[model samples]
Target: METKNITGLTEFILTGLTHQPEWQVPLFLLFWMIYLITIVGNFGLIALICNDPHLHIPMYLFLGNLAFVDTWLSSTVTPKMLLNFFAMSKECKIQFFSFAICVTTECFLLATMAFDRYVAICKPLLYPVIMTNRLCIWLLVLSFLGGLFHAIIHNAFLLRLTFCNSIIVHHFYCDIIPLFKISCTDPTINFLMVFIFAGSIQTFTISIVLVSYTLVLFTILKKKSLQGIRKAFSTCGAHLLSVSLYYGPLLFMYVLPGSAQENDQNMMDSLFYTVIIPFLSPIIYSLRNKKVIDSLTKMLKRNV
Candidate 1:
């Protein structure tokens, strides 16, 4: 990972969400609570899926992995942000690597989940044969490996740039854009890599999601039985909500152009995806999913 002039800057200081002294403690408390809820919610869902025999299908399998990723993703950023509220924090390359991997993997996983829904709804008979155990495992592995590959490519490119300028990062966490802005060496290649790789990943995965859901929607509308149509909507609703919540901020932050005044908006956008989405994911799943709620209730009854 070593490159020219990289040794001198061993660490970078993060300027957290706000510089106001009054807001520090409140921000810490708020995010601390949010972090706790995110961990419990995601992990609780994982445990529920594992313990419940009914949730052993391919959909929940993908969901279990999604929950795991959400936990890791939330941990990657929120803890560091929470810590920054109390004292100065040092940013490292690992933070960037972890965040990139989680975010990239999530993009693929969401697309995979969309495909899973397509199979289940669009082709009910073949759903069983189509979404086999081996295929599900393969999909999971592909999502993870795809993320790893993307992160490795970006990290390799990032290593080429030298940060000889100010070590103070404006954002709460170690993100690629802020790092690129801070580098003394030319980061044009790095920016291109982000646009190309990140853009391609988003475009490809989002295409899959859109196509899959479009098919599912058409299938649902074609169902003559009102009950069947309702069931199909119920099945796909949670996923659609999750996708919207996950992608909306991403599109705003990465795809759209920003101005100097939008720095605060950028922070708010970052906070939404990194903190809010993870916290809300399991809630969306649990509330919208009857099986998950039933499983939780059953577990509580068993213990009580």
Candidate 2:
């Protein structure tokens, strides 16, 4: 009954990643460099893949999309975070909505990439027939739509909650967990929904990746050529490292007990996925890839 007198929240005060004045400038500069590199790396990858006819295969196509997603994923949070370090704080639904979509899409895309690897390595003879262009298009569409559906479900539930008291969000961005903690309304159902949808998405995607890699492993074991086995392992190694980096923090942040996810730790985890991963992804994909390097060298020579 006493709650009737309280006013509703129109805006939120984000506490951001850190409160120390001295750390703000350095952090801002660090993330500024990261954001710039992420944009350049991802966009550069996209351009390279799109222009090179030799790279017009399922692997490069998926890598291109992954780059695109990583760009948006970093953009959605890092700018806001950079501003927040200077005590400029603002919140909006668009930021969270976009971030949610990118995160989910990336998860599905990773799984799709894993399956692509499985087909290429485990069923090398049928790789061309099995991974048709139509199938690739469908997979991409499914990832985007899956992300859209997940985002809609969470946002719908979030709209029902009331924020009466503190408008100060404990983290840099407007994340679901932090919002839940600050809401005056009971977030039991929201948390439950997260457990169902988010958990299922992560679990399902991880399973696909694991199963695909396992099959690929078995296929490699049977191969007579040691060279083929090394090549197979090398191809999968980049993706495995990427998956570990991308999913490890997410599992820790979302799947684990809520008791373990303190604000500071959660912010750090978020930073790893949202900032560090995006910057690292293109490098991971391109560093050891002879084709990408060769294409780059050719393009540079032509321009020069």
Q: Among these predicted structures, which one has the highest TM-score?
A: 2
Report the Cα lDDT for residue 149, model 1: 96
lDDT of 2 by residue, 1-304 (tens): 3553123444678888888999999989999999999999999999999999999999999999999999999999999999999875767566778999999999999999999999999888999999999999999999999999999998888887888656788989878888888788888998888888989999999999999999999999999999998888888888999999999988876666375667898888899999999999999999868789999999999999
TM-scores for all candidates: the values are 0.95, 0.96
Residues 7-80, candidate 1, lDDT per residue (tens digit)?
34547898988999999998899999999999999999999999999999999999999999999999999999
Question: Number of clashing pairs, model 1?
Answer: 0
Give the Cα-based TM-score of candidate 1 against the true structure.
0.95
TM-score of 2: 0.96
**Model 1 stretches with alpha carbons more than 4 Å out:** 1-10, 256-261
Would you list the C-alpha lDDT of every candidate in the order shown?
Answer: 0.88, 0.90
Instruction: Identify the candidate with maximal lDDT.
Output: 2
Error of 1 at 240 (Å): 0.6
